[model samples]
Target: MDTTPLRVAIIGGGVSGLSLAYYLQKQGGEAARPIEVNIFERKATLGGNAETVWVDLGNRRHPGKPDSPYRRWADLGVNDVNLATYHRLRTILGEIGELERMKPLENTESYFSRDGSIALTDDRELFRGVSDPAHDLSQVDGGKLAVLMAVVHRSAIELVESRRITPRYTVDDFFDACVATPAEMLAAAAEELGVTIDWQDPALPARLERLRHTIYYPRISAMYFADDRGPGGMPLQAPFEYYRIQEGGSPPDRRYFEHGSQHWLEALAAHVTDPSTPGPRVEILRGIEVEASLSPQGVTLTERAPGEDRWEADLLIMATHAEDALPLLTFGDGLSDTHRELQHILGKVRYTRSFSVCHTAAARLPPNRNLWRTYNIEVRNPEDTFFPYRIDYVANRHQNDAENPAYNQAGLPQYFVSLVDDLNRIPRREMLERRPSPLDGPSALAAAAPGEAGYRDRLPPLDSDLEAKAWTLFKHNVLDADCLEAQEEIARYNQTTARRRFEGRQDVCPLLFAGGWTRGAGLQEQCLEQSAQVVELLLGKAERRADPLRLVPTGSQARQRHPQARSFTSVPTGS
Candidate 1:
């Protein structure tokens, strides 16, 4: 006899949840298992922060203003999904023998480097279609590839040697660190890696923390073009094909999605739902304001749909933010401690404010001169007067394939640049760069916090530090740090950098907690990487599988499954 089709409910239609749904569907195959998947999007549309709101339909991206951006704007920054994530995506496609139909995203292949430049990155083997083949990847000219490779090498060493990075050492002790930063951060990183610090600044601790997470989160085994650190920090390269295959045989386009990295989320959802498949159905609900509650009978989600008094779901999978979900989760589940801890953690989360200005214009990229010149910049003014962050240009992509559909999106000939500078000292400059300049919409500079210090304290337990000891030693240090003043600044600094508080907590959460926030220190790439990871995990057939529509989707089954969700209650599910 067959088992009752496990109903799996995935919340949040954003990239992470969507990726999970896609992978899960692929693993089960069409009709292989009943997966009633429901994706709940708070926004009226999908693509969480990745979605772009087209302000003016007719107006061009720029009215020829000096600082006019591209014809469109994407709030989140992400280009390519890394090799590890891409590997699973490819495997999923291969399993179904539908890999050929997949096409590379247009304008989604490159990124502007820290130095006001553009760089191309892509997996050559995975290239179903390459739009804008000649896309300008500026970092190649500067030999960023070497730096990147060095980083991979260094990460392998740290992961194998120390197993756990210590606070006093860094990898720079072994390899020459390239990415420059405040002296103190660089130094702490060096120390943690068993290296040394080259610079100063109270901000070092936060950067050190970020650097460590970058080197060895989820283990180095999952990295692309990276040899697992050998027993002696000298692991021999296996057959080059093994490494090259992971590279996707494609030339690098540091940034791949010209419109930002949210498109994959949509693509994943599309793959999961096929009318022909006889499984738990997939429902995508959007624009439904949420009120949550928890109880003895799982969880409950209630919403007011169009002309409907109430809607409900059972066994909800909170794919949204941990912070937003904190209050929404009910303590009645006997997970009250977890809820309370999470709530306190969210309170301490620190983040950054983001801003952008869009303009409509028609300009083919890659000036007639050397593509390298496209990276050249004058800073416009460094005195913190009018410009708050670095200024960059969007050049015409070098590799525009006729087969690429997004060429039209690219052909719009637009530019969108952003800046992440000293939030404390750049307001005067930021004010001058404010919006209303023929761009699409208002420029309030959306600000969001990243890390929660209170939540971070819990990491020590998750890190295995509290298992045998029964107490996390780091907690003592955190509470008793010298000059809590400097620690606060470092915390503040991180909020503006990558702006996600989730990086340090990865090894613990089996279900991926993803977004621009958790995508490592590089906010955009990390988030995309996370979305990709869930794709692999879901595809790998992760556990805790229930009806996908158990909560987020509609109908009585959902109501039965999640009677009380998102709200506190006396009926705790746990004893």
Candidate 2:
């Protein structure tokens, strides 16, 4: 029997790749052969989307402690964690001893029109003093509200049914099939209110146009899809399931890590590399771009740079974005038919670029401070078909100590993160360089005057008119219908190849994939689940007690457990 260890090389160091390394080392002890894992990340940092940056609050001091400067850590990319749906992620946090670090957050939102009209707000306080707040539903009229509710109900029903039937349908396709037409909405409204609505009314077309722009278009482009291009664009598409998993549940039990998401990512890296742990040898290679050449014998990996040593691995696992993984497979040597087929499937996946700015930009949020919520979305152009410019998260309320009077003083700046489609909207001079700074004490801040160079260097901009703390740019995977179909094809191919190898076939595919792109909505949960499946494939399933992964209930099962639960709706509130 050959007892030599299996050499596995994994590319990309995002959540999916990091989780794969952790699981592979943990379960390798029980496998038929020991394993050695190598992870190569192009970036210096491990966390991909989970980036955290600590910002200086300038001369602001902690409440009741004048000697201490006020500072906080903010997540630039991935911030909130939905407890109800993130089962695998929670388990991984527990295994790493970071579960208790999660803090609950009140998930509230408000939407504003470009002209600063409060289109909708879920926070009840906004209507505390107003009688018939429903009458204050400015711009959102009876016909539009009726259509929006009908669309939401129909879309929810279709999302539940589409899992079994038209799984490849896009949100646009589902809307066309299930949602009522504008004419139908008008007729229904007339029948319900015992009044006639003339098709020739000059206001009718404008009302219907507002319904599409305010309700239908923003729901698809701004919120769910998160793309600048409307659903008609190829690379900006989202499948039915993508929207279903996001908006299909009751108000998510939202939480954020105490120290930020990168803390747990660093913990996972530490767990895999700890010498005290009993697991396979794991080597993490940072700041290396690897190219691979495959043949019938094995995989040969070499640094993209010249004069670099080439390493050989028996198996290769690509835990990267589908498009990114394709370029890593080199064609210097003749390629196998199976490898070509894999590349073809991978090419089907698509992605779009977006910018996230972690700054103190009050201009991005609603002008009226009273309408603010944890999530404030400003529609810069409500009439436009695509409305993607909005402040996505208010970090001060979501992650910082909002009750601290010192931080919320009249002159102090509030932290905000805006998701923008146009990079030019973010002022470049205001963007702070990306670098971690040590926490400065109050004495350090008081050492410098307002006009001194030391004060400018040590403090973040005190007012929104000045520079911001920091900014970051990232890409989001587009989960369109074509991408979803590609995922299914990859799964089928893997299963068939695995079976052939089990039957003692000499010719077998050596490559496997693990990433959010390989499964459902591209989220942390899907990324972790795919990693666990890869581990099970390499090493047989572990004993029940030793298994670190557990099955998360399906959406229907979760609903069954909470029958009285109201399905959470992001639909703008109005008449």
Candidate 3:
């Protein structure tokens, strides 16, 4: 057996794989043998979809020298984001001492639900500010009110789980299980979390319907319980699984500002890479398409440099999104049965697209407020205002002159806006041309839609063992979080993806999978999270196994992030 440093190949320069490469390099300090890692990206740039893109068809102008704030630039995709990403980012920035210079925005949502003739909003900072244990939640709607009576659900969930009230759930249980309820899962969720209905407000069916419409993001529509497994949208798990998330379970970090998010990615890249360094280098390949093959040993990689085609590694990680990876692959000539089965798994996703109209106000925005305003406007030529979904504006997303010197130079006010919720209606190019995008408006960030996911069973073609092996390697690298029985999750989707690479060292293996699709089904935050997770798996932090823990039938687009992501507990194997 040849014992050499593990030569790793990473395809896709997005967050997941990049983070994986980063951790692998850093973990080298603790490794017995040095680890060698390399990256191959199709784009000419390194950030993949996470980088800031400045696309101008003549509309990219500096905000009226201050009159129209964010009129200058626009992030093509993945901007206004979840705060859970912030927690980790904050620690990173603090360690690097760029916390103050980066100027991150820290904000949280205060939701208030209402119904017919009864509209309420949680607009008061008092709700967030008050530290009373028995405070009133009259303003808020839904069963979340009941859970809050005890403590912010997460704190309470911890108490219940520790005291054995539910005896099975804990604060760290959310992604690993599922839960559901009639009308609205909140009622069942509250009961599972040990919340008591001490106060009196039984609006009966009205409350139930109201809760259904207002509690969570209505678009998600339904909830499936963790222990609901006897059909009718239930899991066969034990009762403990139901209340686990509510009993102090924390949602992923959703507070991190993107500016801060980018800072960390950039810093990590800087820390691990140096153009002049020798050992194993992190070479970012841009604008090069994967003609075929998953590893350099299998196919030829053409680039601007002479030695670019010679790059190869013992280990290759395909961290591309599942959807994007599907088309770039070709199955082996044999094992048609297994290949066909995997096709169904890959076929279940349904993505929707949208355009983010980022605007530097045509006039100054009301000072000091980031808001979502609704308007019914009339545009030029009786066309009826370009977009009337009621603009949800993220003010001061860009730097303000008062806070950062860069904003002072731009002149006007800027707002980073994401106008979501329009998958059903397609916009004509003329519409996009007439109005402003939420990012740079008029030249919006294009439509976006995250679909659902499901699972299937299959095997790799025997004749194309090399392709099978290569795909198997890549599949292991993209297992989302690893909480799922590693073996079962791999079987669920890999047979299909691997089948695409049936021609051995051809494009079959090297085609490389990237993006959020690898995690069953990922949309926005979930996709971004998987991008981080997949990179780790590809880096060898995630180990391959023989079978899944257990298979649970899910929708065509069922997405669940595994537990073995960019996690500190299970340090990846490579570094």
Q: Which candidate is the best by lDDT?
A: 2
Best by TM-score: 2
lDDT of 3 by residue, 111-185 (tens): 221212222222222222232222223544443543443333333233233322221222223212222122131
Error of 3 at 52 (Å): 3.5
Q: Report the Cα lDDT for residue 490, model 3.
A: 39
TM-score of 2: 0.76
Q: Taking the tens digit of each residue's C-alpha lDDT, what string does model 1 give over 55-76?
A: 2223334346544343332322
Pick the winner on TM-score between candidates 1 and 2. 2
Q: After superposition, how far is residue 348 of candidate 2 from its true place, in Å?
A: 1.4
TM-score of each: 0.47, 0.76, 0.53
Q: List the global CA lDDT of all models.
A: 0.34, 0.60, 0.35
Better of 1 and 3 by TM-score: 3
